[model samples]
Target: METTQPSGTTKRRVELRITRPTLTWFARPTVTIDGVGHPAQWGTGTWAVPDEGGTRIGVYLYNRVWRFGTATRTVTAADVSLVYRSGPLPVGAGRLDAA
Candidate 1:
């Protein structure tokens, strides 16, 4: 939605909820809006280190977080800006962008 500003400029408001566990780390990710990078959501580490091994080798062990629901969001009002709603890939892995 948008509204006319007192200065005759346009003002827009957008509400986004990143409830996905996969998106809660390294701060929020960035997406392009009008050729600009915008932080919209976040994610946490997907792979937990394995306590079985000593050190380096133990890090190989990884796991996926469980999910309770799924969702998606977008705001392409002639701006092609997508805020990316929920399930936004795991952090620390090659999950960002394309997996």
Candidate 2:
């Protein structure tokens, strides 16, 4: 007799890439998916999302020197690549846009 594997055993992978502007300073960026945080170092990476949907992606930039200053953005399922640019103040010093 022949046996077949279950379809649910397969996993889907999503590729994520991030770029940072040259003028950013004293800020550390991180990417969050489904409330899980991942390093946002300038490069390429991969992540796994739920098969049934309902995934939230966010980019946060933390300013070490400033205690109350941080930048964050959360969105639904969308493009995987993002670009980080410099903003005006420390609270909004970093910005993430679809790349």
In terms of TM-score, the best-performing candidate is 2
TM-score, structure 1 vs. true: 0.29
Q: How well does candidate 1 score on lDDT at residue 48?
A: 20
| TM-scores of all candidate predictions against the true structure | 0.29, 0.57
Q: List ranges where model 1 is wrong by over 4 Å.
A: 1-8, 23-27, 40-83, 86-99
Residues 1-99 of candidate 2: C-alpha lDDT, one tens digit per residue: 458556665365456555554545676667787677876676677666555445666666666665322334543356555555555554444555666
Instruction: Give model 2's TM-score versus the native structure.
Output: 0.57
Off by over 4 Å in 2: 1-10, 66-99
1-99, model 1: which lDDT tens digit per residue?
A: 565335423344333323344444333334332333344434322222222322111111013433212222223333211222334444332221111
